[model samples]
Target: MPWYAPRHLEEALALLAERPGLIPIAGGTDVMVDGNAGAAGREYLSLAGVANLRGVSETPLGLAIGALTTMTEIGRHPLVCRHLPALAASARVTGAVAIQNRATLGGNIMNASPAADNPPVLLAYGASVVLMSAMGSRHVPYAQFHSGYKETIRRPTEILGEVIVPFPPDHAHHYFRKVGTRRAQAISKVGLAAVLAGRPGSWECVRFGLASVAATPILACALAAAITGSDHSVPRDEELAEALGRDIAARDDIRSTADYRRRVAINLVREALAPWRSQGGFDASH
Candidate 1:
């Protein structure tokens, strides 16, 4: 087995260019499992030494999170908690404290798990990823990243540079819910993240995202459209929830049944939007 650690991202990219099949490991939370199971390959590219890829800062586009930024860092960062509360919430519960301390945000993105917590929040926020290669950098919106199960649009030569989330509007509301099989260390059976803004009398347009409910994490555009401009009454909310459950595709899997998932998802939507309907604001800032 061979290991290479490059201090700079450019240097790492050059190494990757030279050795095309090397597996990149930032936080080994995911890779170590593969290695322990005799699945991780012989060649590994270590990203631990990359200094520039390990911080969170503000940019013109809301927040800029370096590729190697740890989930623990994201969970506690004031800017992240303030502007991206759902993301902060997701980061906090990713894998408990020790895992959060070492697992990187890029690791989650690159891992591309349908049960992952991060992607739904990114989708809800309409975040973009910065991909860099020997050629140049390009920003890809989160929705376009995943092509299939455990697959992404990341080319072999490119590395995720940073995650960019546009600043949320002043009145925006956010909701995130993750339902796992058990109470602890369980994978998500269903998860939902939503961002919406409304006034006292009208239901505003929204963005809804979810994971573990489909082949890939998804932005529930159809569901959002169904609820947009609808009244805040309970009957209408329940009707829309039922309609959304019907429209979404859910399948029975080892962790849970499709019927259970669909039912829970609809209920979760109601629970998440309760505050929005009752108080005319999000509970995050309340």
Candidate 2:
């Protein structure tokens, strides 16, 4: 198979327009895995040489993280840790240190796996993705980007350029956790990334993004609504369980059963909101 490494974004866009089946590969972590499993393309468009697509920068909206920015960079970047702590936490738990060094955020997203780590955080943060083609660029809300399992709205001529993430509101409670066989390297059986805003009993935002329990990573809108609508600081387990039934489409898979995933997901949601239930709200000092 032939590989083309384009040093510029324009050159890469040109190649995509000219070549019919060229797969854009940034970190090549997922691409190499696919190749090893005999499910890769005949040719690949290597974006590793595209220097423009590899850093995090400030934008008017908030932060513009280049598509090729590695997990290692995101995990430790001061801006990410300070502004989007949940994202930084997610990046830290993505695979192992070696994989984190090689896995790009764009690659993690474009791979379209329900078990992917960072996407849930992106969803919880209300992030948007920039897709660029030779024609121009367009921004798609991350929530609407995925069409189905292993599928995305990106056109063949377009490449993911960057991700735009707005800062969360003041005093927001950020929670991120992944339930896997092991702590570090194992794929998530159920992963959650959430941001809770506002005071107890009178909630504002309850954004919860869940993984490995649906066809694609999804925001648990139904469950969030149940929590916000509740009279108590947090909704009861029974109410949460019912709401979760509508939010996730868990299926029995090799890693875990549908019932087990659903149970764990609900438990995680309760555990995340324990502070709100015990105390009036989460303490910002911590």
Candidate 3:
């Protein structure tokens, strides 16, 4: 198996164009695992030498996170922590310290696992992925990027460049929760990310994202709308929980049953929403 390590984006694209089957390797975390199991075979195109595809930078619109940025970098980035705490939280929960240091954001997305932590947070943040190919470049919304399990919109000749997370003004509150066999180094049975804006007096806007409960990481618009329109002061906790459970289409899996996951998701949402209620309204600082 041959490996090509190009130093520039254009050179990398040229190599990809020349060999369409060349798998792009960033952190090599997932690739090594799959390769060991004879899943990805031996040939690969290493992105390590691609200087352009690393680091997290601030853009005029928001933030541009390069594909090679490690999970550890995302977890520790002050901008990420301040702007998208849910993303930071998710990054912190991905594997352990050693894995976090080597697992790249692009690898996580390209893996397309239902339990991948970053997708839900990205969906909640309304992020978009920048993909480049010999043909050109295009942006795909995070919600639309994943087609199904182990599948994405990326083409054979394309590589994920960066993730663009738009800035949100006004008061914003984010909540993230995950359930698994144990706390550390465990794959999620279910995970959720929620973002709410506006004062508690009025639920102006809301976004909900979830993983391991659907075909792909999803934005629960119906659930968000339902919560936003309802009376904030009403003590209908059980009803709200029930509503969220109904909106999620969880299915049975080896890790757990669909009913259990749905119930847990409902409880998690209720707990996540509790903070806003306690403040008498949403706090801008929180």
lDDT of candidates 1 onward, in order: 0.83, 0.90, 0.83
Q: Which runs in model 3 stand beyond 4 Å of their true positions?
A: 35-42, 200-204, 231-235, 238-247, 283-286
Q: Could you tally the backbone clashes for each prediction?
A: 0, 0, 0
Best by TM-score: 2
**TM-score, every prediction:** 0.91, 0.95, 0.91
Candidate 3 lDDT, 1-286, residue by residue in tens: 5678889999999989988888888887787777353354556889988988988888996889999999999999999888888888999999999999999998898888888898988888889999998889999888899887788989999999999998755577788988999999998999999887765447655778888998787787767766766665634777666667656778998888898888888777777777767775565655
2 versus 3: better TM-score goes to: 2
Best by lDDT: 2
Q: Per-residue error at 33 for model 3, in Å?
A: 1.4
Residue-level lDDT of model 1, residues 60-140, one tens digit each, is: 877999989999999999999999999999898898788999999999999999899899899989999999887789999
**Candidate 1 lDDT (Cα, 0 to 1):** 0.83
Q: Which sequence of candidate numbers ranks them by TM-score, best first? A: 2, 3, 1
Q: Identify the runs in model 2 with alpha carbons over 4 angstroms from their true place.
A: 35-41, 200-202, 282-286
